[model samples]
Target: MSTPEASAVSDEVTTYIANRIGFIELERPKALNALSTGMIRGMHAALDAWREDPDVLAVVVRSQHPRAFCAGGDIRFLYESFQRGDEAARDTFFIEEYRLNHAIFTYPKPYIALMNGVVMGGGMGISQGAHRTGGLRVVTGSTRIAMPETRIGLFPDVGAGWFLARTPGALGRYLAVTGETIGPADALYAGLADAYIDDTALPALVDTLRSEVFERGVDVVACVERETAAHKVVPTPDTSPLADTRAFIDRHFALPDVAQILASLEAVSGCEEAEWAEQIVGVLRERSPLSMAVSLEVVTRAEGAMADCLRRDLDLTRTSFAHGDVVEGIRARIIDKDNAPRWRFARIEEVRADDVAQMFESPWPAAEHPLADLQG
Candidate 1:
């Protein structure tokens, strides 16, 4: 049997019509909308065309699945790349992925993300980089946002570091370190979403946006905002559940060392949100220590030029792949479902400075910052 995407469209043209908002929906639901190489290249090509097309004013990216907009990078394909040791494939994917994020950040025309379902890792990359981050009229709900990459021995990529790093207080550090799941309230509070609406309203919104045969001056964003307002459910947390978490997050997560942060969390007991702190306590303990260390360090330090973060991330990812944990972590956590990882260090406290510090070191060194092509 062919894949659902193969059955639906060929040459990566997944409904490339330009009625109103140039609409391109990711339809590979069986993979939970995990982005494939084809999907990435396809999106790049479509967006490149739309940027030049006169009639296309905006773009509406959607997926057929109600459960997830995008869970993350297609690990199955990534696993293949890892096994084959395909350097070119790895570099192309990252370059394209980073390019996609940059495009969303700088798209000339108004770009909106209908973050209607589960979005994480790569999902967060695109959604957060939306021209309208925390945009006014998202078509999904609070229940669908999460960033659980740390548990699988991976740091939050797809601009997680960039977006989260800029969030108020230490929430970015907290979310990246813990890989905790948050509802719409927490997601919005952390600036992960703009507005939260139910999935039922999505179809009509898509139709209204797409089917409109109109003058070029139609304000798409305002229309979406007004139309989507009736269903708006801004997550109103009582006390920014993120407050206590962010304080503790900033305190320790900002420490110079990852092991130090782990020890600090282990010792933290009397803080205000002690219960939630303890609750996520087990979560931090279970995540890959190496990933936690790098995520914390890179995110804190990934300032300066925007391109630098992507460049640094590529190095970190390549190094992480070479390290044994991603393979073992995926084996235990995803493929075999073993849930028993013989980590390089089982205990977070046992994770050493050098162990975590090495993830930032690049193999290419000074003359070759894998992303030099960014010099445009």
Candidate 2:
């Protein structure tokens, strides 16, 4: 076998191309490789180089951290940047991050993601885009994925509107409002992952890929599928909490309005699923009312092309920083550890239709839009 050659981009991430494979590893274990703006820039540079390299037939993305592929973006950085009144700081992050997302989503060669541990927020932004492109998404028993952004006063902005909107029934709405975590079995059931292979087999799987001979005509996903099948186990569908809550999620979340969704849950407050209903209602109450309302509207309006949804998200991201609850949410939950946020709206009922509508409008013209270059 040929020896592998690799290059270090930064301490946070590393890149290498060996034997027809391009490997990008997120390397900040202490922070679980939480994406800083520099880390995003590094991955983008690697992808840009590999996109044109004929020698690189496939790309494998994973983290050096054993416990988490990535927890999310560097929220502490975002908070501090916003506080310092650095006008370009937050904008630069989202603009470049979303562009990186579009690049990964539309990359021509096979992009394989070894999603080993906690994947959420920006982590989902990167992984889910690859999953949508027929790329390999290998999950393990250790994999825990969620889009729990509403808890921190932000909507699920990293293409959640595009992909989650298309999930069966109103399950996307349920996930948006409640911020529930799902394991590998539920992830597969939700169409968020391609295969579930145990953590113990990961090294062997990587070795097989590294040593295997490559043919130009071979189907990448099929090749990966065959390799993973040797280690794949049938996860119990009943073990998934999402599976248990399916009927309740679909029925109540199908309501057109947020108020109606709440009313539907409240009406069922005394039924057999009363405890579940109340718990959901309580979660909604604790989250930023503006965030919950805007998230509902964001996902509800996610009806167009993926690029279009991303463009819409850029608008929401900008607006949220200007007038939304990001500061309060981060301050209470992350900084103070108080578990209490004094949101702009005291109650869900206080979030009016116009307030939600304002978030969906674009602040810039089509030509001037930062994401105007997105192809797909």
Candidate 3:
């Protein structure tokens, strides 16, 4: 848990600033920078300190590897706690994680996520929330992002409803349900990424910031341009595989519910994106049936402001874990990787309307709710 040097990260943590640009680099590359409670606490403490510090201006968040900016939250640890029946442990992680998310959303300074690679589920949540709720004003996340939470038996949390509801077209539900990877091109179009710099350019960008050469009206776009010039990944929707993907998504997900949609996809003929539909449909088929249903209910019903949606999300998340896809999916994917998840309900048809109702039933008494103290 060593603290970071000005630009170089330590074994578990790193912190430093040069030219008014600060960075908090996650150093546990082997873990793919998957956030544990310890890591979350470390990041929380670091960002809190930076909030009021004057010398540290714009903060750049990155990691020590190419594989991921962060793969996701440390679900392995959560699964263990989950199996051990450690409610306190689970609550500590989720509560703190959400608190950190809320803080990042409202953080007072410019927070730039150096989303180099392998951003997914929990990774997307943390990075996604940094998009311009506004403090020091320079806030950004990435289309380098992907919220594949549902794929692994989790829902899209961390203001997902907030960001996705605002995303173009019907993409929110498409990504939520299918957990497909959107590259730099789609990332730009989806507003998930602000700038599409090539991954190799990261070191140079860091070096520039570390060199004490920054100026007022410091050209972030120019920096991005210099780095990304050689490898500009432009999104061409006409030529995009996303067009067919989009159509299939709208066709299936646009239906009234998961059951009807799955049935429709199964029966559809001559789908232009047949293979694409089948691939994504397979992902949906692999997902937890009950969790999938709960998510459709949550995302579509998300209303009011981002905060309101998040609060509702907390309830849905808590209830879902108690009775949804998390533990089963975790066992199949991580604990065993057998890919044979014996979901509570074998199929969406088995997920009765009452079952969906029960899934939304909050486990925590109002006073003991996980996010009771959150401002939203």
Each candidate's lDDT (Cα)?
0.69, 0.82, 0.68
The prediction achieving the highest TM-score against the true structure is 2
Q: Each candidate: RMSD to true structure?
A: 4.3, 1.7, 3.8
Off by over 4 Å in 1: 1-8, 11-15, 132-139, 211-218, 234-256, 270-272, 365-367
* TM-scores, one per candidate: 0.88, 0.95, 0.87
True-vs-predicted CA distance for residue 184, candidate 1, Å = 1.5
Residue pairs with backbone atoms closer than 3 Å in model 3 (clashes): 4-14, 4-15, 108-136, 142-192, 142-193, 143-192, 143-193
Candidate 3 overall lDDT versus native: 0.68
Worst 10 residues of 3 by lDDT: 133-142
How many clashing residue pairs, candidate 3? 7
Over 13-64, each residue of candidate 3 has an lDDT whose tens digit, in order, gives 6767556666778877888788888877877887787777776666677875
lDDT of 2 by residue, 266-374 (tens): 8885577999999888888788888888887778888877788789888988888788898888888889989888888888888889998887788889999989878
Among all candidates shown, the one with the greatest lDDT: 2
Per-residue lDDT of model 1, residues 1-376, tens digit only: 1112211254423746455456667777777788877787777777787787776667667776687777787876666787798968877787788777767665666667777667777877666766443233263663466668778887877666877788777777777888887767677677766666677877787767655544552377766776767775544643455643566677766666666766676776776656755766678778888778777876787665556777777887788788736767777787889898777777767777777768878888657775755521
Please give the clash total of every predicted structure, in order: 3, 0, 7
Sorted by lDDT (best first), the order is: 2, 1, 3
